[model samples]
Target chain A: AQSVAQPEDQVNVAEGNPLTVKCTYSVSGNPYLFWYVQYPNRGLQFLLKYITGDNLVKGSYGFEAEFNKSQTSFHLKKPSALVSDSALYFCAVRALGGSSNTGKLIFGQGTTLQVKP
Target chain B: EAGVTQSPTHLIKTRGQQATLRCSPISGHTSVYWYQQALGLGLQFLLWYDEGEERNRGNFPPRFSGRQFPNYSSELNVNALELEDSALYLCASRMTGSHNEQFFGPGTRLTVL
Candidate 1:
């Protein structure tokens, strides 16, 4: 089985402050992690993914995430938050070794990040 | 180039009625995927079509079905729709053998009433 967990329901931050939204995963094999942000009534937009190499991964809209294998965590981070950065964030994981081509994504419950001005 | 596109941004249907959702993949993409985003639920994989064949499907019932066209566009048909079928149906496309990234469309919102 494969799954991702986002521990925070909502994280509020003042503009210009750094923000972090945590995510952890459980999978039979190594995990291929992803981050997507969804604004209200919109489809999710891909932010970044952690496939292999480089524990640190950068994504769109000035966001990044660090993958920690020992802790099975891939936490999303932003150096300085902006009001436009506020949205629903989701963490997803897929088994590194799985039925080839099934290629399904198991997603976390999602976290809402609100950056206030 | 155009991104993935889905039709009928919003649809309302009564219980037991059938519904069909359409999607046109990115110009050169060959793999089309369908996902269900119901309220309070994360995106759930519903179907995958590639090269005019059904590749893999999620744990959805047979009533949930779809097909890919020669042009790589696809259609998802829900037979005997139930109230629970109300969701934002998302269509995504990836080039063949893409290791990770899949581009998504705006998605079709289906309302059951």
Candidate 2:
């Protein structure tokens, strides 16, 4: 089955410091990985996705993620953390081939990032 | 372009009652997907609709069903709602094609008492 795992339930970082939110996935074939952030009482906002191109993918709000095929990991990274960046982050994966080409995403449990001022 | 939109931003219902949630996909988008985000269950796909047809569904029960209209908008109906059914129901949309990412709506907060 296709699945995503965000090992950390919470991550803490100081403002202006670099932050990394780890994610690893399992799927039957090549995977489509995505990162999304959700604020309290709001829907998820798309951050970035790795389809088939360059491994380093950049997205909205100064966020980026690195796709490592060997390790099956796509970790979200930010050069500098901000208080506004503190939110619930989710890692999702969708399989590319076979019967799992339904385009439905399998999401991780989510990670909460706390950026201290 | 306008993004996906959902109705009844917040809903409160009692156990055994039914709930209906609606969604309008972004213009020119033909695929609409529904997901449930319960407290414990992170985010699970509920149903997928494209071009007025039900394309796929998740591991949910028959009580959890939905349909897509001719305009490509959709509605999800949950029968015999239980306390566990209380969750944030999210609606997402994408163009009918490969390698397309879905855009989500604000979501409907359904509370079952």
Q: Rate the local accuracy (lDDT) of all candidates.
A: 0.91, 0.94
Each candidate's fnat, listed in order, reads: 0.54, 0.69
DockQ of candidate 2 against the true complex: 0.85
Q: Give candidate 2 regions above 4 Å deviation.
A: none
- What TM-score would you give candidate 2 relative to the actual structure? 0.98
List, residue by residue over B23-43, the lDDT tens digit for candidate 1.
Answer: 999988998999999998778
- Which digits, one per residue and each the tens of the lDDT, describe model 1 over residues A62-110? 9999999999999999999999998999998867565633766788999
Candidate 2, residues B1-113, lDDT tens digits: the string is: 88899999999999999999999999999999999999988999999998888889999999999999999999999999999999999999989777888999999999999
Query: Which interface RMSD values do the candidates have, in the order shown?
Result: 1.1, 0.6
**Residue B7 local lDDT, model 2:** 93
Clash pairs detected, candidate 2: none
Off by over 4 Å in 1: A98-101
Model 2 Cα shift for residue A35 (angstroms): 0.6
DockQ of each candidate's interface versus the true one? 0.71, 0.85
